[model samples]
Target chain A: MTIASEPADGYAVRSRILNFLKYGANSNPADPRVPFYRHPIFVRVAHWTNVIVLTVMLMSGLQIFNAHSALYWGYQSDFNHPLLSMVAMQNDDGSLKGVTQIGPWQFDTTGWLGASQVNGQWAVRGFPAWATIPGPQWLALGRLWHFFFAWLFVANGAIFASLAVYRGHFRRDLKPKVSDITGLPAEIAHHAKLQFPKGEAAKTYNGIQRLTYFTVIFIIGPLIVLTGLTMSPTLDSAFPFLPWLFGGRQSARTIHFLCAFSFVLFFIVHIVMVVLSGTWNNVRAMITGTYEIEQAGGRHG
Target chain B: MADGATRRGFLMRSFAGVATLALAGCDSISQQPWLDPLLRSAEALTMRVQRLFAGNHALAQEFTKADIAPMFRANGTLDPGTQEYRAHAQKNFADWRITVSGLVEHPLSLSMDQLRKLPARTQITRHDCVEGWSCIGEWTGAPLAHILALAQPKDEARYAVFYCADPMSDSNGDGINDSDFYYESLDMVEATHPQTLLAYKLNGQDLDIAHGAPVRVRAERQLGYKQPKYVKDIVLVDSLDKISGGRGGYWEDQGYNWWGGI
Candidate 1:
């Protein structure tokens, strides 16, 4: 059951040789090995900052979106309703008194009502008393935080990207090899079988990891930034093309929501993968930049 | 050995501090009398800042023709399903005259053709709906200020009320009357805003029936609903006290803010 106390003769060497032959020639101890992480201190800081800022942005954005419970286009079509609605109180005159229950067509005192006349007169909904806290005021504050933090995010990303190219981090960590491209079926089979090395964590990412990281870096990051900018009226004036790139303000909003959803998905998968591979060890390496490797058969080599 | 404990204590203290700040922020969630004043002041301050910034700058980005969406869905009461509206529509809107009256020194009932002949300003702007959809289209129309100039609004005029053709008697108390046409009012400030216009054309064509044909008001800075369509009359008033629900717009009277600037 253990590597030690078994034998110190030809049997031990024969077992080691057998293990190497079974796994691969690359699994041999004498083979050249990749470092656990090639990420620099700045890169690490940027990554963590991005994580925090993005999380805050998403949470704050949700709060703002909740302000307008219903959405519509053109004039005022009620094709879709908010996910939740509360029953509204009504007066003897058939006027809404307040919200009594929460359901579709229920009166959400907080929701935006379009232009509609009541009792032969125009009436609009008042901002709900409960919404006063994270109301327009809070939204404005959040906007300030989002915009200021965005600068840091952009700077960090720009630095990381330039450094990644200049320092060959992209080439070493993300570049797909010719074999990875040509042997796509084998690569997929390896993933499908979950045949990655057991004890030793992948030094560089596997093919799927590389692709996901690349897409997040090149595609999702730019999208989040561009869509966020498109929402800015001031920014739109400076760069008219930005709004056009994402359709319009409304379309940009849809894209922004979709991107946030994608980021959430990625975060869940990343956390799950870390736990699956080796939770404590992976976390410790990320924090302390070092990890103790267990030798084959559960002994420190 | 002590250093590790000290570091852990520091980390714990920092985390506790952050938690305290977060909790303090969350404490505002509960409604309080004082919080309302604070929020009001904050909103006012934000509006002031936004207004100042916007005034100093040119209008928000205007897009080219290629950027326009192939299809823009008409929002709100597509057809103001009213007998009066249907009658006007049947007449090809020749009988439809926009009455510019009330406090105006010179009241006028201008036909669609007359209104179209007035000097017009065309701008490609985004229409942001509170419901969370947006569309950009080229709108061409006469500045509302220009119309007010022609009508010669009296010195007491404080608001411009849009009277729509849709009626409100049929809804059976859903707060939204199927027979009621949408109506909105703007303070003299927004009414006279340079960008505010009585739009009759969209994307270089006469407004379609679904899009409040004949004429509509475009309060460009505000949300889409403020842009009252199928406008029948523009009534200048000194006070909104007597207006429907005294909130300014139909939706405003229902509980929405009259000034829905982004």
Candidate 2:
């Protein structure tokens, strides 16, 4: 079925724009009333838990990455080809020069991603001190933080995923149907204009929402976890094929970094959407399992 | 009981265990009588999982000389400056002997010259340090497999512990000195690995003092800390529990993972 493509009726569009600008429009002249159970208790709990676990994992991961500020592809790093590197190259002079490089492009990332002074001494510490946990160049502590949070993240993900599957929450809600795929172009158009579904349409996730949720949960999460295991030398011996599957240990490390940044991207978009859409209502749905919708004819359901 | 109830119970118990461990802190919780068994079990689980994934004979990747780090900074204690080590170093280690004993049917003391005469294998491999830096270097030495074959470890032998002459202790406010010895151990699988070498030469030159002179055991598949330098003796054992700190290596004794494969 073709989406109207004529843009959501002007009244709905106008209300959405006003609501967005107002930071969540609850007072629609045409009050559409619907109290939908947007998020279940299990989903809400998992979401919040993941918020903490992922944040710690990301920061601690950066700490561990700082130990070796270079990334490459293949079983071993040749040092000749680095997919990404954040480090300071010593100049002819006594001073340290910070550089962040990807492929052939080099950027001076001093005091930020590459090198920065901590405790008034020059160090080759990568990713800067502020970005890492413990805020020092301690690999042991970094590993501890990373492994601890990693276990938590994996356990939480496993439980949430299994429940999501068994409960059909994924199928009934997040899954995109044939119509969603067909209507994607129109949906993209609406999204480009910062337009969101309202009333009945808001009850269900939009096409882009379903896709993003599915990708983050299924694709991004598993990729990071598996690639992480691939980098372990012990695991490499046990699962010798893991390195081959990912091209090599360094390749796995690079993929893990990329996957992490992908989550960061998802988080930014998620926050933006949460703020743009009715922040109060969206937050309420997550916390109390209740969502207020703007239905047509100023009616409340 | 319903599946949901069982799942809830499991989740709650897991969370409670995590909370207890966290509150106790790794050091204190490890000292706790009850948690010791649990933590050891967790460590065992990690080792088992890695062993299951990694093949016993799987060789670590070999690299070309071009991949070697321009400046491979010496890690850990660079100088094993014991009076005995200095005496041997003065004579170019001609008097040094590496004793292969314990749990072995044939105990042999091989000198540097004898070791040089043995069949040698040279491979360029990357050394992955637990501290996160890595360096590739060409190591030429007699295969550890051949040495173990000559020693003929008894049936009960399960581990090969390499004792180094490095004085790792910084006791009495002095810098790293040879008051304490450095040592590392490897399981039978690692000990007998084809790539495992008693490396005496690096980059076509004799091993320097900064590197482990006389001899260094290269357990290629493990982290650099597992590669002990200044080889003074090799003791085969049925178990590592009786060793100092009972964790397998000096670093492992200091709370590093026993399995330093990563």
Q: Quick one: best TM-score, which candidate? A: 2
Q: Which fraction of the native contacts appears in each prediction?
A: 0.17, 0.31
DockQ of each: 0.13, 0.24
> What lDDT is obtained when candidate 2 is compared to the true structure?
0.80
Q: Alpha-carbon error at A260 in model 1, in Å?
A: 1.2
Candidate 2 chain B: worst-modelled 10 consecutive residues by lDDT? B23-32
lDDT of 1 by residue, B71-108 (tens): 66687777777667789889888888988899988999
What is the TM-score of chain A, computed separately for every candidate? 0.62, 0.87
Candidate 1 local distance difference test against the native: 0.65
TM-score of candidate 1 relative to the true fold: 0.52
